[model samples]
Structure formats: C-alpha cells, structure tokens
Target: MARSTAMKAAGLILALLIFTFFSLAASSSNNQIQILNAERRIDLSSHIVKVFLTLKVENVGTSPASEIFLAFPPSQADQLALVKAQAAIGKKKKKSYVHLDVNPTQLPDAPNGTKYFSISLLNPLSSGETATLEVLYILTHSLEPFPTEISQLESQLVYFRDSALILSPYHIKQQTTFIKTPSTKVESFTRVEPTKFAGRELKYGPYEDRPPYSFSPVIVHLENNSPFAVVEELLREVEISHWGNLQITEHYKLVHAGARHKGVFSRVDYQSRASVKGASSFKHLLASLPPRVHSVYYRDEIGNISSSHLRTDYRKSELEIEPRYPLFGGWKATFVIGYGLPLEDFLFESPDGKRYLNFSFGCPLAQTVVNKLTIKVVLPEGSKDPSAAVPYPVEQHLETKYSYLDVVGRTVLVLEKKNVVPEHITPFQVYYTFKPIFMLAEPLMLASVYFLFFMACVAYLQIDISIRK
Candidate 1:
C-alpha cells in the first residue's frame, strides 16, 4: 500500500508539472502576437446581423505564429451561424484573397467562459512578419424586439448589442467599430467615447493600445422593417429515378420571428393604406432554383396557391411566391414546393460503377433561417450500401420508404441538422449501389397484373361454368 501511494503521488506531481509547462507556453504565445490595426462594420439593415472584421496582425515575438483566436461571449456564440475568413496577398493594387480555415477550439484558461475559434493561416507568420485577414460572420436571432409586441400600424424596432473593441486574445494597437442601421430613424444608442452618429451610420472608437481581451459593451436601438422569415421546420425529400428524372419536394412550416402582433388586424386599413399600414408584415418571398426545372408547383394546406410566378433561363430559375395572407409578427404558414429535374444533370456514375446524386441542401428561400432541417434522399428499389457525403457535420441515419410497386421498399438516407441558415445551402452527395436489373421490377409487376386481368375477362366471357348459366 505504501508503494502504491508513493507511485500515485509521483504521478500527480508529473501531471502538475506538465500543466504548468503548457500554461506558460500558452501565455508566452499570447504575448508574442499583436494586432496592428482592426476594423469592424456591423450591418443591421435587416433581421439578420452581419459583421465584417478586418485585422492586421504581426508576430512581435521571436517565434512563429500559425493561428489566431477570435473571442466571443457565450451569448453571441450561440447565435453565430457562419464564419469565413480570407487572407490578403501581394500588394494592395494587385492582391488576391486566400481562404483560411476557422474552427472552434477550447482553451483551459479562457476567462468568463469565453468561446474561441482559431483561424489557421496558410503560412505561419515568422518573427516581425505581418498578415491581413478579412472575416465575415453572420448571426441569426440576435436582434431583440424592443416592445416584444406591436400593432399592425406600428413600425418594427429592434435592439442590437455588441462590443466596441475587437475581441481577440492578442493585444490590439488601434481599432474602430462602425454600425449601419436600416434607416436614419435611430431611437437610441450606447456611446462608448469618441463616438459619432451621422445619418444611418454610427461610428465608435479608434481606440488605441488595448490590452488582450478588452471589451466594451454597446447597445443600439434603430428602426428596421425588414421581414423576419423563420422556418420552424423544413423537410426536403429528393427521390432519384434512373428513368431520366429527379424529383424534389420540400415542406415548410414558417413563422414570423419578430415582435408579436397585438389587437385585431384591420384588412380594410391594410389594403387602402398599404404604404404605412403593416410595414413590418411581409407577403412576398423569392426562391432560386436550378435550370431546366419542370412541373414546378407551390401549394398550402388550403390547396394550390396562384399568387406565384416562375421565371426560367438557361442559367437558373427564379420563383416568386406570396402567401395566402400577409404574414404579420407571430403569424404562421405551412406550404410545400416541388419540382422535377433532368436526371442527367444531377445523377452521375462513378468509376467504381457506384451511382450518386448531387443535390443542394437547406431551404431554398433566401434570407431565411430554418430551426430544424431534415433532408431525405430516397434511392431506388434494390439499392444497397447507401451513404451520404455532407460538407458539414449532420446527424445521419438510414430509413426505409415504400412507394408504388415497391416490394422491399426504397432505401432512404436521412440527414438532419439544426439552426440551418442560408450559408448551409451547399451541395451534398448521396451515394449508393444499384443493379441495372432492378429497373425491370416495376415493369414486370405491371405486365403481370395486366395479363391476369385479361385472362379473367376471357374466362368470364367464354366459360360456361358460371352460376347464371
């Protein structure tokens, strides 16, 4: 027992030594890097909040720096939807942008449970070397409705909260924050110092010599009447047929995510005074679709809706649709959109003789957020070894779907994701193995049914063993 206790004590000592070493290393690395200049522009022109950040960073220490960390409070981190970064190369006049990899990471010594995402540089910055990075991040459901409830005639107002300084682990020399609202009708804003308000734009800072993790919270209240379309649930089904066609159907349960509507709605006032009445309500939405789409249809629970138009070109198709009624704050609608496409465009054969279908994921509607999204790819009967290749992380599983003339049912690959945004609308591929002979199953079944029906008719007409005879 004594020997075991001594061994355990020794292990604890070693672990403590290792932790101390790593902590010191991280501290040293943080001290080595600094931001020369930083600029942030917050665009609050719509329901969605978009932030653009530009940072000029340099390695002031004697070591190389390969990654930079972005700091965000826990509240904002939950609302973050998309983050993309690019690095500038060459001179200013003739420069190109290269994409950088940004991924969430955990650090043990983070203060106040701050979340961090590390942006990896293509090439490490040596001592005294500098690099410029441009980052664009999108946040959804970030704006808070001021009153939380409003009348139809009342215009919408929201509150946006953010930091005046750029949140970074490294020290910053100079930084500035600019905020642009939808209209010049600003209600109120929290001024940090050295702040300027001109028209619809608010400028904050040019703060200099900020230490690491410096933050100053600011809130802005402004007028914004843009539609806040949020899809509570969306299910997209893609059925592949080897007979030269691909079918896609999408079901949506949509809601207005802004302030709730109060009192009774006046249709007469809304129709006559359209310019001022129900300014916060929306009735029109647009969807972008692929080229050569056929048999496109849109409908709601009440049946086919005629208030829709489709424009097609060689490049792409645009679909404009309006709900049966204008969607006010807290209003809800359910609908479906379906279309068919040429199979040759989306289906392809691999070198290994496997078949795959390339299709777009996420809701087709523009500037909308989906709380829950489910994509189902139904493969033909007799398909085997089904798999999915999505660019991002998603919950994937297999299911069976029985269709017309299906004996063993079609194999379905289901991919589920939450908090889906417009940025999630990317191409995803579903791969499976299918034998050509399976194509004849439905045809043979139909032929057999027709032959049996003919034989029964012939016997009924020609045979003499009937009860009536």
Candidate 2:
C-alpha cells in the first residue's frame, strides 16, 4: 500500500514537532516566576515596620511545578493592613492575618502563598517549584519622648507606626548611665526583646521570623525637654491650572537628629542649661495647612524666613506655619512655601465631558542625596492628546508657537525624576487633550495687530503730495 502511505506522512510531521517544543517550554516557565525581591524596614527601636517580599520561580519543565501568586498594590495593601492591626493590638492575640484585604480575586487561597486570607491553601505545591515568602507587620504610633527636657529650649515628639499612648504618673526610671546602679552596661535595653503593657502602655515584639536586617541598639533617656528635630529633606509641589488656579509649593531640608554636643555652644552654658530643667537644644516643627490655600509664603536660600511664623483664616480658609531657627543638634535648614487655590479643588468632571486633575506631594527621608529632580507642567491653552505618566523614568519634549499676552503659550509638560525616595510621593499623574483652538490663537493674534494699525492710518491720509516734493 505505497509503503504504508509514506509511513503515515512521516508520523504526522513528528507529532507536530513535538507539539511545538512543549509549547515553548510552557511559555518559558511562566516568564520565570518574578518579583524577585522587595524590602521596606522601619524599626526605630521596635516601633516596627517591615515588609519583605522575595519570589523567583524557574523550572524549565520536565514536570514538577505547582503554584505561585504574588500581587499587592492597593497602597501596598494598606501598608500591610496597618502593620497587621498594630501587631494584633500589641499582642493581646487575635491575628488571623490581622485584618486582611489584599485584592486581585484574592489570589488562589493564600496561606504560605499569602494572598491575604479569606480561604488559604489547604496544601498542594509540588512540581519543579521554588518558593520563599515572608511577611511581618507592626505599626502603632512607633515611638515618643516629649514628657520633659529643658536644657536650652526646643522639644516636640510624635511619630506613629502602630500607635497607642497614655503615660502620666511621673517618677520616670529608664536610664543607663549618669549615675544609677544595677549596671547591665546599658547597651540600649540589651538590644530589645520585651513586650506586654498597661498603665501607660509599653510593649515590644510579637517577634516572628525576626531577620530582615535585624536591628537592636536602643537609647531612651526620657524626660526629653524637647528639641531634636530631624527633617532630613522634604519637597512638595501641587500645580494645576485650567485658568481657575491652584498652586501650592513647599521645599524643606532640615536636620539635627540629636545626641552629640562636646563643645562650642554655651550662651552661659545655654543660660544655665535652661535652669536645670535640662535636656534641651531646640526642636519644634509643625505643619497643617489646607483650606482653599491662599497667599502664604516662607522663604530661604537667603531671603524672607525672618524665623517664620504665620497664622491665617481669611474666613474659614486656615493656615498656620512656624519656623525660624530652633532645630538644634547638627543644625541645617532650607525652606520655601507658597499657596493659591481654586481649581475647583482639583478638577474632575467626566461622564464624557472630560477634564481631570489630581495631585499630591511630600518627600524627605533623611536626605538621600537627590542628584536631580524636575517637574514643569502647564496645560490648558490647547491641551493636546497628551498623557503624561511618571513612576520614575521620564523624558519627553515638544514645542511649537509659544508667546504670552492674553496667552497662546500653553501645553508645556516636562517631568524628570532621579534617585527619588520618600515612598515616591503618591504615584504622579498628568493627562491631557483640551483644544479650544488654542484659546482663539491669543485673542486672534491681538485683534489682527490692531486691524493692521488701523489700515496704516487710513492709507497715510490719502498719500499724494509726497511725489510733488
């Protein structure tokens, strides 16, 4: 039979080339798993703030890979559900993934795969698999120390992570040196590892898996008279204008995280160290302004900043700013602030009517040597089909006819980012597409140049005598 139909068409082309090489090795092993590594640690002496995610799966199939899923974006799952509900109410117990809410179809029942509870994996992950997951959270008003400290004036404290506070009975006792026996060499509470509180609360450690760049070297000589301000760095900008206005800018760089005063700084030993109330070298910083912002300014870079102090409320529109030297302990400062508002309080009018604008700003985490930072956004003269996006890497430029008078110059959007930290200031966004004939080409080119100079002064009064001369 003609050689068995040519050997059954060569065995159906070798079984379609072995099913296209196992479908490209199962799509390159699901694109080599992913995530690889992620970290966020803020311990500050057991106040607790840890987020570490590392994943990598590569099997190259032969048969042996089970399951894998990792996805967290809703503001990093609400900062890991407020650090697992402040470490389960400071460990009174009741931690079922502590108030879980990590969306995305709740990722196939997370347990060891942690999809954020609501039906964890009973068990089953065997193949050519590779796994590793670790999640620990605890936030509850991180730490504080502003009960009392006078020395040279300046004190204030309040930093929350998984917060709680209620201290008031005085008789303080938590020192290390400066005379107070029972020595353990005060290596800062022997590198922390204590918990359980009440009567002015004091708890530390639910201690599970402790190993993400471990830290323990404490220091708390309370009765802090106040003043150890540490801003490190801060830059804020909110710009939006569709003619209705809304601009608020702030730039600050401050330091003085305390502890280190050997010599040189003795105004009569700081006026007798502020009369023995002791523990002072200045630190007072505060900010809270938002109410249809108005013309409020504070400058630096060699200008304005006469030790700053402003309080406003032009009828229910509040503002309170205070700053002008008093941030001692390795002192350093920088400033800039501005305000103006009314862009319909951050534009939004859709339903097919188009027009949207949103903004957020504030970043300063111990001055991480910012190499560069630039942001220039001006839209609404004739906003084209623009869609600006920046989560870090950006470079775009386009220009045409730009001139100002009644205005015709608009559509300038420039964004540049580098090094950036401080949690990337709320995912920047800028989109456009507003063209009303570029606002009538600058008022019709200034009324056609004043009607061609009034027809050249009525044709120069009917020119004639000029030739006879």
RMSD of 1: 1.9
Candidate 1 per-residue lDDT, tens place, 308-343, comes to 999999999999999999999999999999999999
State each model's CA lDDT, in order: 0.92, 0.43
**Top-TM-score candidate index:** 1
**lDDT per residue as tens, model 2, 189-269:** 222444432333234443433321133333333222234444444444555556678776767666554443433555565
C-alpha positional error of residue 82 in candidate 2 after TM-score superposition, expressed in Å: 9.2
Clashes of each: 0, 31
